[model samples]
Target: MAARRHTTTRRPVLAAAAAFLLPPNPVAAAERLAFDDLYSGWSVMGASFSPRLLALVGQEAALRGYMAPPLKAEADFFVLAREPMALCPFCSSDADWPVDIVVVYLRRQAQPTDPGTRIEVVGRVETGSWTDPDSGFVSQIRLRDARFRPL
Candidate 1:
């Protein structure tokens, strides 16, 4: 018996099929939890991360959401929102996103996704308060060194 090589046609077909069958990956995927499941409580002052979220800190999390407009024309960080925000959370001093938003810090600047495009963000969850020194925006929960793409 002789060894044989695979054809390129089969390789492309297999690659395409693999892309569809697999869930969207961001950095790496861990146990998936919905945005609704991120917080156990929501309030004006702040929200508490659900035990599920708190327990997953420093672990990868996959959160599905839309990309909100960044505070600056360019930002090191972006916000993933459950819904398209009509107002700017940073520009509009009174505006604020839901407590569950996952503040995504991309390894590098990524082309902003469509506001309507649903994206999956994955990164190590950081649970606590932090302010963006450049923007002064406050966040209770964030996903550091995150990456995302349309779902």
Candidate 2:
């Protein structure tokens, strides 16, 4: 009897399965930003965004920080701060936001987490002064269409 010959054909099947299971590549990776890099100069009058920050406007970016309290229980927007804020500036007048704070406008409404929890936010960087029509909250810089994940 001739020795049995077996040819395995599983390699291609395995490769195809891997390709299907893998996560799709993002259109573009977000540029990581540090709070210290948000500004070139800061004063009582106002702050000037760093050249790097300015150049990144309209581009996808990521910032790691604490998420300040939201205006409502379920909201689409929140504030990202280097530290936990004493007050939710967007919802209060007694406390003011830090110059380097970045407003985060999420793509969908979400239940906010504790103020102390650190988070990483991803979105398109938007510069210049603007006020939210609904809340009348003024912001110098913001992350539009943003989303966040706990750190």
Candidate 3:
């Protein structure tokens, strides 16, 4: 009887095969858009959407920012700001919103969270200025049918 010996050369091939069989990463499919990339020109009137933003309209996109408090306890929308907002803009009259803030409308109701928490949001990019008929919140950029996770 002869003892069997294992060959190390097959390990690489097996590893590659296993990797190929795995599902594709969801993050790779989403186009990452930074807060800086949201605007191109700033004027006394208002900021203009960048070319990158224009091209990404109606496409899947991802943004990372702090999750501001929701407008109401039952509302499905919240504000995503460049920095952690100390006060809820919707609730406080004196809370000045950022010029480049993104209004995020969740696909489903999200649990109330602390305003200081950092989060990564994924959704379809919506460009152009539009006012939410319900909340009357005006925004230049928005993420519709969005979902988020803590960063």
Candidate 4:
């Protein structure tokens, strides 16, 4: 009688190593932040940014939310909402966005992100009252220099 020994090759391990060397998707780097943590206070006048949001200024923050209708379909900025927005921005001039909204300023004019879509936004958390020169929309909490993609 004879006994046989089997050996495994290193090719599979090498292939796995190569796959790991590939660059990671940019969207994967966006950190998730909840709406509850976006602000500490809510009011008609203005809302205060939470401590977590304040600390993220000038840093990339990822917010998972729905897209509120833009003031204009072709506007540069759009509001990220916690829920599907029922109000139309164009229909009502007095209609205000939520206090926790993260104003998204896209890098370029692109198709609006899906209103029903859950998206992650990566941008600098800008806190202050700033008026949009193009749309004249006022916002206390903004996510400037931002980019977004559907989740």
What TM-score would each prediction reach against the true structure?
Answer: 0.74, 0.75, 0.76, 0.72
Q: Write the per-residue lDDT of candidate 1 for residues 89-124, one digit (tens) a residue.
A: 567655556656667887677788788888877778
TM-score of 4: 0.72
Candidate 3 residue-wise lDDT, 1-151, digit = tens: 1221233345446545644775533444566778988998999987889888899999988888998777778658888999988865577664467789999998899795677888878889998889889888888889998888775
Distance from true location, Cα of 6 in model 4, Å: 46
Give me the candidate number with maximum lDDT: 3
Cα-based lDDT for every prediction:
0.73, 0.77, 0.79, 0.71
**Better candidate number, 2 or 3, judged by TM-score:** 3
TM-score of 3: 0.76
Instruction: After superposing candidate 3 on the true structure, give the runs of residues whose Cα lies further than 4 Å from its correct spot.
Output: 1-25, 87-95
lDDT of 2 at 104: 94
RMSD of 1: 10.7
Q: Per-residue lDDT for 1-151 in model 2, tens only?
A: 1331111144335435644776532212566678987998978886788988998999988788998778657778887889987764467664456767789999888889789998878889999999988778888889998887776
Pick by TM-score: which candidate is best? 3
Candidate 4 Cα deviation (angstroms), residue 91: 12
- Quickly count the clashes in candidate 4: 0
Name the regions of candidate 4 deviating beyond 4 angstroms.
1-24, 42-46, 88-94
